[model samples]
Target: FRFFRWVWRVTYLTTFGVLGFTAYSIWEARNPADQLEVDQSKKTLVILGTGWGSVSLLKNLDTENYNVIVISPRNYFLFTPLLPSCTTGTIEHRSIMEPIRNILRHKKRAVRFYEAEATKIDYEKKIIYAKDDSDVKGDTMETEVPFDMLVVGVGAENATFGIPGVREHACFLKEVGDAQKIRKQIMDCVETATFKDQSQDEIKRLLHMVVVGGGPTGVEFAGELQDFFQEDLLKWVPQIKDDFHVTLVEALPNVLPMFSKQLIDYTESSFKEEHIEIRTKTMVKNVTDKFIEAEISKPDGTKAIEKIPYGLLVWATGNALRPVVKDLMSQISAQKNARRGLEVNEYLVVNGTENIWAVGDCAVANYAPTAQVAAQEGAFLARLFNTMAKTDAIETEMRELSAKQSSAKAEERTAILNEITERQKQLRRVKQIGPFQYSHQGSLAYIGAEKAVADVSWFSGNIASGGTMTYLFWKSAYLSMCFSTRNRVLVAFDWLKAKFFGRDVSRE
Candidate 1:
């Protein structure tokens, strides 16, 4: 027994030794401490915003060649396409957003991410003035971050058209806060309308929801609001039976100016059938605390003034250039004539600026401010950066080779040098590629529950699908488009839960 015990002890020690040695090997190979070192020699590529464009670029960038620093007020990349669903709790906000840190995992090197808003750009100094909001209240504590190359992906802000009282009285659906506020405000309106002491007129006005703008966002929100009333609210609190109403007002002749004529027609018909009123060609000229003064223009150039009363007003009237962007545009001579956004060249580089790039909604790419375009631009910039890095690497390799070829045979050296020259030329060619081009995958919009319209490229389609099957397709398509599979699963689960059980009405 003693002999067996001795053998067992020896075996255990050997096993432990092997395990320790293996771990040491891994530690040496990985060089954990070395990985943490920020590469100062490499070009510092500082990118603003954690939106679709910036995230895509970061994901595709060759981390080894650049010391990448990402700055944004928010650390997570929001899936904007699924954002409309968040208003009605169809998909939880967290489920749609992918943390920026997780996305940077694709990189070979560590990326420095800062949660801040860029205040100003110093072109001469090659530094950006930014405000870190980690500890501050409403104000931003400022600092400077120097960059060798910069990418401005800061997105646009919602445009309220400077209508009186619109900013204060209406809720704009742009960010997560807006969606959350809208959700809470909706419940508040419902609850206020349900008050026992409230008069019929007060209740009627409170229940009369007004959505200004016939864009996809406004239409989607209107549809979701209608669905909430029909599916959940009516069943749960039948008391507000005839109280709830949804009105969509657009200045244009039709809603969804971007979509096909058939889709717009379908949307109109769908909203009408669901008892949602659509007041097209009605421009809201002035907005009071409780009512909107609109100018209804006739086709023959005649215009009539009308007033619309409402408890809750949702403004989804597209986007305007952000103040910071506009300020930057004004300072630059190249951007002097630019009004909307930063004018960028074919390489996605801001015009008249060397080593500066802009992407997403902040870029005047002549594309809609959609996730698809932003992501595409980001990917393109990533490739551009990668190519630039490759060109640098090739140049370095050629220099080293040239040094070594000093004592070699002239003919052999020339042949080898020629090969290096050819490779450098190829790399340069890749780096010189033109600005980004956007590929349209077509549009998709959810009109209501169990009904959707997709102008997809499949089968050369201008296809508009409605009813239960279309809903399934819509859900599936959106789920697949989610940033991560985990997100997809979570969104799917949310939909299933909503289908099986009604939406949660508690304020919390």
Candidate 2:
């Protein structure tokens, strides 16, 4: 009886504590402290994009060091890794998006945010021209923002490789709208396939889904689509289930080229089990509204042209430099030879530019354009800025002390000299910041049918794992990596809802 009473008391206390914390968090979010007024003397730090790179920098940056302004077309940071799940309704799009305002509110000082696209940068003048592209705008639609230091993290765009009809007929999975469009298209195709008096040939074509590229994004999307077919679509539209087909076409020799050979083999086998066809060494020459023309190479180095019909085509070939990035490159002589993106120095400073730095897909630092790399680079930049700010302060103090020492009495002069010596040491320590370095955290991917693969860096070695256990690891890792508790909770609930009730088949 005593033990039962103790358990009840503990439960009640725990519940109350949780409720109190929740209430406090809500209140704090609603009532943020007024931001410190911008100090005119401080340097203005302008950041572009709200992607992994920019967000990471904002999260770690000391706002007191600079007056920060963020400019991006998007006002929310997307969790790109889970974007594939959104295509099949396994995870809702909103679940993975954390508003930029929500993130900025937690900072010690308020940051200026502009939901506008950076049209051009006047490097010599240290000014950026941004335009409001929204539907409704005020009298001032375009303005010039002056920055003392600028960070360009405007990520890349979808690469179509100049394939014919790709832009008009194919869907690129890069943003929330893309995922929502894919989901709607999938259902539309399924519904059309189920129309009365529909011929078998047309039905077959309508139920066929084709994905271009063999990278992680393409593979993951294929997996999620297959899962949707097997889980929700099969139960909801069983008539077209047997005719559904998914094909992944890659020009390379194999899928998941970045992954280990063993893991790649495992993923292929898993995909085969899920009835997802993988066609390697098949270069797509053209894409039409109804079908795609491809050249399939034989083992004997012979190639045969073939036309394949698809109901829905997802173009995930890769990334390309955005026009803004290309324009910036053209303006900088040192970046003229940069084919992929802007070339940067060891510290991520744009070549031939002292005040401009770049990160993420916009920067060509000889690193793979991955979220992990961008995030690490952002954090490194934050630390570098902090250190630089400290060095500046120390140097200012040292100069003042030196001047005071020259004008002071003997005793005061001795004391000022000692302080100057200490300040010099501090400045030296602050200036010793090394160049940006990246530590690979390894790779992870999900290949349907309750399976996943991971090649993670362990203590002094590598741990390659796959199967259901690895799927759990993948889920936990992504959940923990979510940008905020709100996002994490939403994602968790979505997963649980999908698992329990299955993904919603009702198209919006």
Candidate 3:
């Protein structure tokens, strides 16, 4: 009886403690403390884009050091890892997005943000030309913003490889809008196939979903689609189940090139069990509204042209250079040989420009353009900028002390000299920051049927895992990495909502 009573008491206390802490966290996030005004006398530091790299930098940076201004067409930082789930309504789009204004409000100093696209970057003039391309037109649509220091994190766009009709027909899976479109298209295809007097041939075409690429995005989306088909679509609309099918077309020999070979084999086998067809060694040559033209390589090395019809097509090949990034590269003579993205030095500084630095997918740093790489790069830059600011402050203080020593008494002069010496040592230590170094964490990708694969760095070596346990680990890792307490809570609720109530099947 005594032990049971103690257990109940402990549980009661723990429940209240958690509730109290959660309430406080919510209150604090909603009500930010006073912020210091932006001082124009300080160096103007400008950041572009609200993606992983830029957001990570802002979160770690001491905003009080500089007059900071951020410009991006997007006003929110998107957690892109779970973007595939959005396509099937497993996760809501807004749950993974944290508003830029909310993030800036919690900073120590005031930060300026503009919902405008950076049209042109003038390196010589140290100016960025921005234009507001939102729905509503403002009186002053375009303006020039000058900065003493700039960080480019605008990221990249989808690569089509000059395929005909791809841009017009295929849906991408990058942004929130893309996911919404895919979700709507899935429902549209289902409803259209179930229409009265719909021919069996047309039903088969409308129920077939095609995904191009073997990367994480394509694999994850395919998994989510299969889950939807099994869990919801078949139960809700039975007639189309017989005709429904999904095919993944990859130009590579196999999918998920980033994972271990064992895990790759596991994924392929898992997709087979889920009845998702994988067409490897197949190159898509053309795309139309209803079908795609592909060249399939035979076992004997010959190729055969085939037309694969698809109701909904998703293209997720890889990233490509944005026009803004390309224009900036063209202006720099040193970037003439660069093709993929901007060439950066060891410190991630753009070549041929001292004041400009780049991170994320836009910068060529001999690393894969994953969110992990971008976040790490952003944190490195934050530390670098903070050290630079400290160095400048130390130099200024030394100058003032030296001037004061000249007019001080003999006794005061000794103390002033001692302080100056200490300041000099501090300056040396602050300026000794090392070059940017990337640390590779592992990779994770979700397959269908509540299973995921992980290639994690453990101790001194690697550990590859694939199954239900890895799926739980994946969810926890992503949840803990959310931008704020609010985002994490919302994502948790979204997952539970989908599990208990099933994802909303309504077309949006």
Candidate 4:
């Protein structure tokens, strides 16, 4: 009987030994800790744009986890929120732009940057064809890059529609080049009109400025132009001071459709006070070198056609899909319905492809193409990638232990298996950003000087604030949103200087 009991004990020990060994082996086979090791295998993340969205991603991403590359024609990210101020020299253009290279210096790993425009994206083979301005003029210096992940943050282009002569004569305020052109044109017209030989009608035409589309951009530009005339032109160039005029034309009945009714009234009242003409319900039908033809909706519901001669016409219309994004959509069958931009799923992944992801204005994220949206989306993606890396590590460790179970002791084997299971739960715990939900922080528009409007959240509900206190809040909020502390301090100083003296009149 004693001999039988000894045999049973041996059998029981051996069976459990095999069970533990089997568990370890199976875990190791599946886990492949090395294979699962966060794909640190030189996976390339291609970011396209130096705008707020792409820049925000670059700032937040885990650089050590991937080979990061940024592609954009511009080498710096322009702070566009304060761009209107640049037109009047309230802030130097250079002050609002931070170099892309300087921004990337904060990355854990050096990022590859391309100062070229992406011409085509071959998703079938995962390649991006690009060309620089020098190479775009039928040159043979085009380049191609292969990427594991491609982020399309190319933003949008200015919409000219199909209005005749509009593209040729109207000035757009979408880019830095546009602003510079407008400034130079403004000066050129003023100088030429003030010529001793210029006629009265010609001088009036040269000084007359018409701004189309009363959106935030148009309103802001008009305000800046008025401020320029009131402060600088009136004092510096008094020859054509009486002849100068500024007109804002909007198709909508209200100046600011996005603002509250009270704010809109305030803006209109302010414009009226400044003698700046506000033409609402006015649709520009055609634009000529010296005049603009528009159909005005009258109180009697009749459309009256009128022509207004002007020296400068600024078009601040909204954006349209860029050519690159349009081409990409045509090339991919799954993206056929994506007319606005590349359609993305909840994961920010391209609808058809699993490996590819897109962010920012180029992607149809079901959210407003605002800087705030893109920045948050990019940060979310970075956090997701980081979690993926951790999961891979856990899985790899489990697989490795399973494969070497025969060599590990029973206690060590059991402990390793428990750890792997626990890691799996942690991986599951990582939050995934489903279809994005935008939280409205608030909307603020700078009119001029210390006048602004803001619709912000209050303790009870949303509050519409305007005037001096609102202007102070607007400045503080934008300052805090600046990319760095240095930027915040510089912007603050610029405002102080502008208040104490006046805006600089020098144009670079």
Candidate 5:
């Protein structure tokens, strides 16, 4: 009886402690005293985009050092790794998004945010011209904001490679809106296929889901679609269970060319088990409302054009430069030769220009355009800017000390001279920051049937893993990497909810 009484008391204390902490956090978030007003004396630092790169930089930046202003059409940072899950209702779209305001509130100073699209960047004048593209707008919808330093992280757009009918008929998996559209269309296709008196050929055509590109995005989406079919659609719409099919087409010889050979073999075998057809060495030449014309290469060095009828088509070929990036490149003489993205030096400074830096997909740093690469680039920029701020302070102090030495008395003059020497040494140390170096963490992808694959750096070498254990690792890794506590908690809840209740099939 005494032990039970002690246990109850401990539990009560713990519960109260947690409640108190939560209350304090909410209060602090609501009323942050560190949000300082903009200081005109400080240099203005303007950042673009709210993607992985920009968000990582914002999270680590010393806002007190600069009058920071962030401009992005999106007001939230999205966790891109689990984006595919959003398409099949395994995860909600909101679960993966963290509001930009929520992130800015923790800063030492308040940063200005504008919901607008940057139309042009006047590099010579250091001015950004942006237009308010949102529904709600003020009297002045367009404005120009000048900055002493600029960061371009606008990312990339989907690449159709000039394929006709692709932009009109295919669904993309890049944004939250795209995921929602795909979800609605999936159910729409299924329901339309089930209409009374539908012919067998039409039903087969409506149930066929074709995914272009064998990259991680396409593979993951295909996997999620298969899971949705097996877990929910099969049980709910039993009549079309056998008719459902998913096909992934790639121009390359094999899928997951970036992954290890072992993992690729495993993924192919796993896809086979899941009844997902993978067509390699096949190029999609044309896409129509109901069919895609593809040239399939034969082993005998022959090519045959085949028309594949599909209800839902997802195009994930790769990324292409945004128009804004291309326009900026055209304005700079040095960037004229650059093909893929903005050419940046080791410090990520845009070539042929000072005070401008690029990160993520917009910057060509000889690294694959992955979320991890962008995130590390953002962190590097944060450190670089912090060091630069410190160097500036030290130089200013050195100049002040030198002036004091000339005006002070004999003893005071000696002290001022000594201070000048110390300041100079500090300035030198702060300016010695080396170039940006990316440390490759690893690559991860999830296939169907509760399986995953990973090729991670282990110590000096590399370690490749796959199957159910890797799936658990993948889950834990992504959960830990979520942007905030709110996101992590929400994702955990969604996963649990999906496991227990199955995916929500109510399409809206």
Candidate 6:
């Protein structure tokens, strides 16, 4: 009886605590502290893209130090690691998205956001030409934003490698729209296969799903797709189950080249158990509406061409430079040899440019184009910019003090000199910031069936682990990394909702 009483009291207390915290969060979000209006007198810092790097910089930057302007097509910051799950309804797309307005509202100074795509950057004039690509726009839709400083964080686009019919037929999984298209297409294929008196061959073709690339995006999407069928689709549409199949094609010998060999082997084995066919040493040459032409390498050093039919083809191979980045590169002779991305110095400044910096996949800094690397680069820039602002302020004060010393009395001049010396010391300390250094924390990928693989950097060594536990860790890590507390709560609720009710199969 005493134990039951204790349990009852503890449960109510915990419930009330949760309620109180929730109320406080809601109140705080609704009523943000007033921010200082934008001052045109300050340096104009223009940032492109709403990806990992740009968002990270916005979060850490001292906005009051400069007149900040963010230009991107997207008005929300998306947590992209769980993008794959969106295709199968494991998590809603909006759950991982945080509004740009919400982010800027909490800043010390007002930051402006323009939902426009940066068409080109004029290096000589320090101007960015942008076009409002939204559906609703006024007469004056295009404009130029001039900046004293610029940060190029416009991320890369999907790479087709010049494959024929790829852009027309194959779907690229990179954005929210891409995921929605894939989701709707999956249901469309299932329904089409169930059409009355459908031919066996056509039914098989309609039920087939094909994914290209062996990278994390490809692997994770494939896993989510397979799980979608096994857990939900099979129950409602059992007749099409026997014909349902998934295939992953990769030019390389193995999937997930970035992961450890053991983890790779384990993942391959897991996929085999799930009945997902992996076609390695296969290069896709052409993608048609109903089939793909692939060159298969034989064991005896021979190549054979074969046509593989697919209902849905998802391309997740890799990234390529955007047109804006390409245009900017063409303007600079130093970037001529930069094939992958804009060549950047250790401080992430663009080569041959004094006031321009680059970050994320748009910049080649001898690092992989991943979110982890981009976030670290953005934080480093925030520190660098903050210090530069302080240094400038101190230098201005020193100049004024030196000019006053020429006319001031002897005692007053001595006092001014002492203050000037102290200011100089402070300036030196602020400018002592080192170059950007990226510390690899780790990598994680979910491999379906409640199993995941991770290569984490422990204290003094690396710990590579996989299986169900790692999947939980993957969820927790991503949830914690969400852009806002609201986003974290939404994502957590999404996971719970999916687990209990199964993923939604509705096409939206």
CA lDDT, every prediction? 0.85, 0.92, 0.94, 0.81, 0.94, 0.94
lDDT of 2 by residue, 301-401 (tens): 99999999999999998899998888888888988789999899999999989999999988999999999999999999999988988988888888888
Task: Give the number of the best model, judged by lDDT.
Answer: 3
In candidate 3, how many Å is residue 179 off?
0.4
Worst 10 residues of 3 by lDDT: 499-508
Candidate No. with top TM-score: 3
**Residue 462 in candidate 5 has what lDDT?**
90
Error of 1 at 148 (Å): 1.0
Model 1 lDDT on a 0 to 1 scale:
0.85
Instruction: Name the runs in model 6 displaced over 4 angstroms.
Output: 1-23
What tens-digit string does per-residue lDDT give for candidate 4 at 107-131? Answer: 6677888788999988888999988
Per-residue alpha-carbon lDDT of candidate 5 for residues 1-508, written as tens digits (9 for 90 to 100): 9999999999999999978885776677567676788776899999999999999999889988999999999999999999999999999999999999888878988899998899999999999999999999999999999999999999999999999999999999999999999999999999999999999999999999999999999899999999999999999999998899999999999999899999999999899999999999999999999999999999999999999999999999999999889999999999999999999999999999999999999999999999999999999999999999998888888887788788889978877887888888888888889999999999999987889999999988999999999999999999999987678878999999999999987769
Residue-level lDDT tens digits of model 3 in 56-131: 9999999999999999999999999988998999889999999999999999999999999999999999999999
Q: Which ten residues in a row have the lowest lDDT in candidate 1?
A: 28-37
Clashing pairs in 2: none
Local accuracy of candidate 1 as per-residue lDDT tens digits, 1-508: 9999999999999999978875675454335342445687898999999998998898788888889899899989898877877887877888888888777654678899888888888887888998876765555377799999999999999898788888889998888888898888888889998988999988988888999999989988999889988998898789888989999999999998988788789889988899999999999999888888999988899999998889889999988988778877877799998877999987888988887899999999788888889999999998988988887887788888777678678778987778778877777686676767888887888888568877776655556555567767877888778886557767888988888987887665
TM-scores for every predicted model:
0.89, 0.95, 0.97, 0.87, 0.95, 0.96
Candidate 6: global Cα-lDDT?
0.94
Residue-level lDDT tens digits of model 6 in 1-508 = 9999999999999999988987888788778999999999999999999999999998899999999999999999989998999998999999988889998898999999999999999999999999999999999899999999999999999999999999999988989999989999999999889899999999999999999999999999999999999999998888877999999999999999999999999999999999999999999999999999999999999999999999999999999999999999999999999999999999999999999999999999999999999999999999999999999999999999999999999989889999999998998899999999999999999999899999999987999999999999998898889877788888889989988999887766
Position 273, candidate 4: lDDT? 81
